[model samples]
Target chain A: MGQNYLASLSHYVPELLACLTMFGLILIEATYKEEEKGRGFFFLSAYLGLGSVMTFSFFSLSKPAVTIFTNSLVIDPFSSIMKVIMVLGTLLAVYITSQSKDIEGNLKPEFVIMATGVLVGGMLLSSANNMLVLFIGIETLSILSYVLASLRKGDDRSSEAGLKYSLYGGISSGIMLFGMSHIFGVLGTINFTEMAAALKGVETAQLAILMPSFLLFLVGLGYKIACVPFHMWAPDVYEGSPLPVTAFFSIVPKVAGLAALIRISHNFFAVEGALNIGWVGVLSIIGALTMTVGNVSAIGQRSVKRMLAYSSISHAGMMLMGVLVISELGTRSVIFYSLTYLFMTMAAFMVVSFVNDKYGNDHFERFNGLIFRYPLMSIALAVVMFSLAGIPPFSGFVAKFHIFTALLTKKYYVLAIIAGLNSVVALYYYLKIVRLMVLKDAESKDTIGGFNILNQSVVVALTVPVVLLGVFWEKLLLMADGAKIFIQ
Target chain B: MISLSSYLFISFTLFIAGIAVMIARKNIIAMMLGIELILNSAALNFAAYSRFVNNNLEGHLMSLFIIVIAAAEAAVGLAIVIRFFQIKETIHIDDAAQLQS
Candidate 1:
């Protein structure tokens, strides 16, 4: 009984932390006053943030990760770095929530609870060595996100968005689980590294199952990344979700989900150019389509929220550029780029949320004279926009440069050219939003006016990195290169 | 003893039944139930293949994991469904087509 209890306790700490924090939050919600609920929520989010930081540090420096959970999960430098990303993104999101007068006024603790659950799940996913654990992590994140997405209750559109998320998520998980079963049937193993070796020994005729299995796995993962053909659910969900939650949805999950995708492909399916050119080709094509479609579709949307939704889709495509190569350099590029993307995205959405709060709307016309009125906020949004558009002196340009260099090193010249051209095309649309805020002036005045402190901090927080990346990128570049060593 | 084909056949029927219900059911609850059925069938496959193959711990452990995830999904999914019904007061998916283009 002692041994059994120890085993469960060791492996389940993160999940248990998730459960405890959630329980504490529920208790707090009932006992705390309405105006003070956001404070309690922030405290809970900070607790999870501390838990993540500790786990990451332990995974990096100690042998604790090695002995945890009977070796079901591995905690390594890669997982540690990704954990920090998840933690930062989640903490900022909770901060954004805590500061919102709208949300805190009648707040529910479930917001904090769900955010922590998603963060814990994402951190676990980064280091999931077993396929089953991967599924668990993914579903936990998705389940919590579904609630977060629909949290602005009593709105018909919001509920509809939640329903869409469930159906898409449910189907994707079902497919992924089926694929796992097939993989077990073929290789007789669920561990990713072991399964790779087992599948290698199978005869050519027998490996036919490999294609279907991989296809299903890709679809399951693809939905999370919001790649084209699987991105049917993103726009509605983004538009309907409350602003901070949408911001969280757009940035954090993509990082963890794609990190898992890269892990599966790297660990389970060894990249042999001689054998797996097909997977590379499939990924490259999808990457190309995702970027082009996301960029083009974004241009046509009148609603700023919906436009950002499409922009997020395209960024997924941009991130996949690194995944197609799947080298140490590629992985490092992905990590660095995702880190850069996270802050820039948060910054951009911070401005958007602030604007939405002040103007009481999300239409493009309302954004006119935004720069004239809210200079600091507009500048922050511009910084993110320029960075996203791959303008120099910003980290987005540096991130894309690393990917292009990696692809070139891999001799993927055509893909390199396509990404380059796409960035140029992407520039136009991102600039359109920038244009509305500066080039055109608003026809009508906003009722609730003035720069809110929370948004001011959000913009300041967001702008620091983009400008720093533009100036002192080499420091992070070196760290990225060092991290690349572990990815292989 | 159940033959390998019979076990596979049972899995197939469950999979097919889930697909049918997902396509035909009008109520969101019924559709989600179909999804649960499909996930169970898939989990059974993990167990079945594990038994038939090398009788190793990998397959069984995987099946256990699948069961855990399926339950998590169901709980959250049901919660969402309840939340949706509270707003719309209807369970039929067709009536909830605000997002269809």
Candidate 2:
């Protein structure tokens, strides 16, 4: 009995550590004086402690896949790496928030606490093996995100963003639950492994219900990842939320959502001749539409945040292409792409948040002639932009190249072509930001000032990875490859 | 005795009604009610399926969980709606379009 208890505890070490840190932070916040400056130190310690625990867990828990806690959660290499990524991403986001002008004073601690809560949900999501666990994880993540979106308190836009996010999230999750009911009716089980086993002999008549079940399931996951048809809420939400929350919304949930999708797809759809649901065809079409819509609409956005929102949608589409292939190589590419994407996206949004804080707005005009005043920041932003555009000698290019090569390897030639074309369209808007910053002169010199050392340091720190990952991607790719054994 | 299809038909009607209300309603609270309807329909389906098809308690358990989740969602949704109403003095979603591109 003691051995069993110990094993379960070890299985959830990282999540337990995060939960403890969150409670500790709450206690500290409760005790601190209203005007205390030491709160920042506590927040920093909480993030560092959480990050270190996740990193430690990632290296130490390298055992083969095992189902614990009555098989509701699975601990494996894939989830381990994804959990580490989510934790590190949360740390980066908290750092950016600490530097943002939007969230100030006592709100900072609340923000960190809520962000940590979301990270816990994400961790749950990446490892969930049961439908109930998955649903709970998604809702936990969604509820926290709604609160985070409206964290700007007095801002009308932020409140509206929160409302819209909740409405959309509520409806989609409802639909997903309905789908789950049908799936449960058909399979009589919620455990993924058992469901996969039962699905092997499903009749053709059952396929009718199963197909819609699959699509309905996609609705929830698609909304989380902000893919098309379900992506309408993304731009408004991203535009309205505090910058760090927007950054968090873009990367962490999307990665976790993709992880859930991978789990579902591997268990249900990857079994050839068991259930021929044609999910690949549907996902491929969605991928095509998602990228097209994302890139096309991005061209007209005046707000840089909204443009990044659309770009993220397009990137989701590209990642979907990786998912469609359903091979070890394809999975590795998606994982690797997500890792590289973490750095590029955080760097870009960090620059945006800094610009917004300094200039008071995130419009393209504010970015104009930015290179003249803050040379270091501008260069960092330039590197980030070039990488985001998937230019050579940068991480984004390598990520995209991996995705495209994966598609081609699967003989998804048409998807590869659509993705290739979308890259060109994506390049135009990314470079437009670069042009505004570098080529065009600032319309007014009044806004010129030296870069904030803290902001500049953060931007530089994030950009280094974007460049380093591009040059030495093999290390990350090797790690990603290690995470590909999902179906065993 | 009622058949499985009858329960499914009722659940389907509930689901459709929920979707229609969600699409048609302009008031955020009303839309939230629509979401509740959708979730309850799903819960009903789970209960019915467990009783009639699976012959097990899993679906009933799922419905119970769904109830809890729907309550939590409603709580958060209503809070956001209240916050929005306080800010704009109106509950219509159309007026909250200040962030549009």
Candidate 3:
């Protein structure tokens, strides 16, 4: 038994390293004097730790999938790739936090600490193989996030954001647990493999009970991903939270939730049954509504940050389409979408964070005539916006092409058409910023202090991938295609 | 007199009452209680199902974890609520309308 446990531990290295980093950061923070700013060593070690975690996950991409900790958690190529994306997102968010003036100096370390903790949770969630691990993972991701959302301590808006997040998180997770308990009772197991095997022989009456329960299960995850019904908290939270925290929220949790959603759909509903039809039908409606609502809502927003929040909701809808397809191609496309999304979102948020810092608000008017002042940064923002709108010659287009290919392969024409229309709507709003940047008159000649040499280079570096990935996406798609879900 | 159905009925009632409380209550503290009620209902269901139907430790374990996580969740929820109260001087849900755009 001990030897078997040792074997499992070997597959658990990346997660353990992440946990170590979180604790190490906490301890390291204590040694600093109370008034010290720019905890230089703290951030350096954080980058190194997250970089190593990403390295470990990248190396594990080729290893055969395995169930560790007694079938509670999985270590598979798909999960490993998700981990790499999440760690990169965290690393970049930490960098943004280090540079952005929106968060006070004293609170910056706490941001990294909470972010690392959240990263650990995201890691667990992407690889969860059973209900228990999944619940634990979601809770860990959520509880810390509530704190992160309100990291601005005394600000009423930040406090309100945290309150709303916890209230919503608490309710949805409760509903999810209720559903999971019923599932455990009906299926006689919490392990996904055992549950899937049991699902093969369930009675229609059991199916009746299971259907509602599965919807309840989706509440928690849908809340995490900020889908249509559960997305009410997202805009408020994203707008109210500090910019770096908002950037973190947009990437890590969403990707982790999508990864988990993909795994769950592939595992339980992949086989043909009445349940399959019901699940697909429900997801299709949800995906389409999510896209429409997100895009339509975004068009009316005045704040760029809030608009980006809605845009992310729509993006989540697109990824949900990939999930409902439940094929290798669909999974591959979602992985690629998330990878490109990470860079596009980081670049956009970096620019917005800087602009918000300089002007104290990120309204649409703030980006006016940005091209006249900082041509490189303005062009980068424009490229990212175009990429986000899914225009060709950008990675977003390539990613969307893959999803469309997967959707058409499965002959989901209705969803395909709706998605195409949503892209058109998305383009209008995305181009609003681009238009303001390039065509509108300058509001002020005051240089944005956040656009120093180092930050400018970093923003440009992030945007480089956004433009290059559109042209050279074949290599990344090959990497993403290797991320196959392993069903036991 | 006591069977699985009775236990399920009670837990389901708790679940509904919890949702009702969440929807009906205006006080932040009361709403948190509602959340607790929902969590406890699920935990009770797990325990009862473990005893009456599945006859395994998994349900029992799930219930225990639920209890623990619920406490942790409540702790964080109340902390945020306290912070909100500190800022706005009110725990009313209606007052958190600053980001309504």
Candidate 4:
């Protein structure tokens, strides 16, 4: 028994280390004098701690999938890959925040702690095997995000954003819990595997209750991912939060929410004719609607941040196409798209954050004559924007290509068509930004300025992956393919 | 003894009321109360289901967890409400539309 306990503890070493590091940060913040803490110490320590945790988790690749804590959490390739993505995402976010002028001085430690808290929650979410664990993981992530969204004290917009996010979050999760009560009542089990097993014997009449329950459950997941009809809070939250937090919201939770959705879908919805509630049809309609709403709404936005928020929503819709297929290829494409998306979205947000830092806002007009002044940054932004528009020779195109191919392979022709049209609509807005940056003459030539080395490096670091992944995507595709083993 | 269906009906009523309150109320604190009502209804459903459907204790345990999570959510929600009030001097959500496009 003691040896078994030790073995279980060993399985969680990475998470334990991350938690300890977070506690250490809190302690250092509490104990140290404001003058003695220095400028970069918190961020540096956060980067080291998160980076080390991410690097260490890579070793779990060689280990077999294990269910610890009485099957509440499963450590597998899928969870490990997602954990890496989330940790790396947080690490980059920390680096970006460190470089940004928006969050300074006393707020730095709190930012690190809250972001790390979200990362830990995301990590747990990816590994969750039971509903109870999933609930805790999501709450931990959501609560911290609510706080992070409001971190800019004295900013009315930031506080309002936090309030809106929490209000939506609370209502959705409450509804989801009500749905969970029904699911538990029907199956008498919270474990996904057990729920799947029980679902095989469910009667058609029972599906009446089950179908609505599942739809209600989707509400919580949909809110986290910010799909249409459930995405009202996203633009407000994204536009109001600090840039790094907005960037964090764009990537980490979406990925983690998708991870959780994929896990739940695989366990409950994947079996043929086992529990026919017409989920694919439902998901397809949701996918089409999400992309259309996101693209159309994005077009009229003047604020660059709000436009990107809608763009991210549309991207989530495209990724949903991959999820709808429910096959190995589908999951593989989704994972690949998510990985590529990380770089492109981060690069775009990094540029936005830098511009926001410099000009004190993220207005499209602010980008005029950018190429004439900051040529390198403009070129980087142009590349990132083209990639986002799904143009060829960039990572975004490859990601979208995988998703469309997955839909075609599954004979989801209508969805493919809808997605294709949405891409066109998306291109117009994306290019509008590019045109402003490249062709529109600056109101004044001296407005744009060169970026600092750290900011430039971050942009370059994110851009190289977008370019390289377009050319050398096979390796990452292979890794994504490998990650699908856990789902199967 | 009360049947499971009656408990479910009562809980469903509470859930609908909660959602209605959430939609109709402009005050942030009232919205939070609506959320709490919804959560309590879920907890009630879980407890009822645990007694009627399952022979084990998982449903009861889940309700307990939900209660704890709801408490945490309320704490955060109240804190955000206070912050919003500080910034805008009113708890009406309509007054806090500074970030809208």
DockQ of each: 0.69, 0.84, 0.90, 0.88
TM-score of each: 0.91, 0.96, 0.98, 0.96
Residue-level error in angstroms, candidate 1, position A168: 1.2
| Total colliding residue pairs, candidate 4 | 0
> Per-residue lDDT tens digits of candidate 4, residues A1-488?
67776778888877887898899889867876767746566667777888789877888865778988777788887788888888878888887787777776678788889989998888888889988999888998999999999999888888888988999999999998999989999999998889989998899788889998998988988888898879999998998888888988999999988889888888888877734338787788887888999999999998888888889999999988888888777887887788888898888888887788878888999899888988888999999999999999998899899898899997888899999999999999999989998889986665433277767887888899999999889887676555445563
Sort by lDDT, best first: what order?
3, 4, 2, 1
Tens-digit per-residue lDDT, A125-185, candidate 2: 9899989899999999999899999888888999999999999999999999999999999
Q: Name the TM-score of candidate 2.
A: 0.96
Model with the higher DockQ, candidate 1 or 2: 2
DockQ of predicted model 4 = 0.88
CA lDDT of every candidate: 0.77, 0.86, 0.93, 0.86
Q: Which candidate number maximizes DockQ?
A: 3
Q: Which candidate ranks first by TM-score, i.e. highest?
A: 3
TM-score of 1: 0.91
Poorly placed runs, candidate 3 (over 4 Å): A480-488
The TM-score ranking, best first, is 3, 4, 2, 1
**Candidate that beats the other on TM-score, 1 or 2, i.e. the better one:** 2
**DockQ, cand. 1:** 0.69
Which candidate has the top score in lDDT?
A: 3
Q: Give TM-scores of chain A for all candidates.
A: 0.91, 0.95, 0.98, 0.96
Report the TM-score of chain B alone for all candidates.
0.94, 0.96, 0.97, 0.95
Q: Write candidate 3's Cα lDDT for A431-451 as tens digits.
A: 999999999999999989999
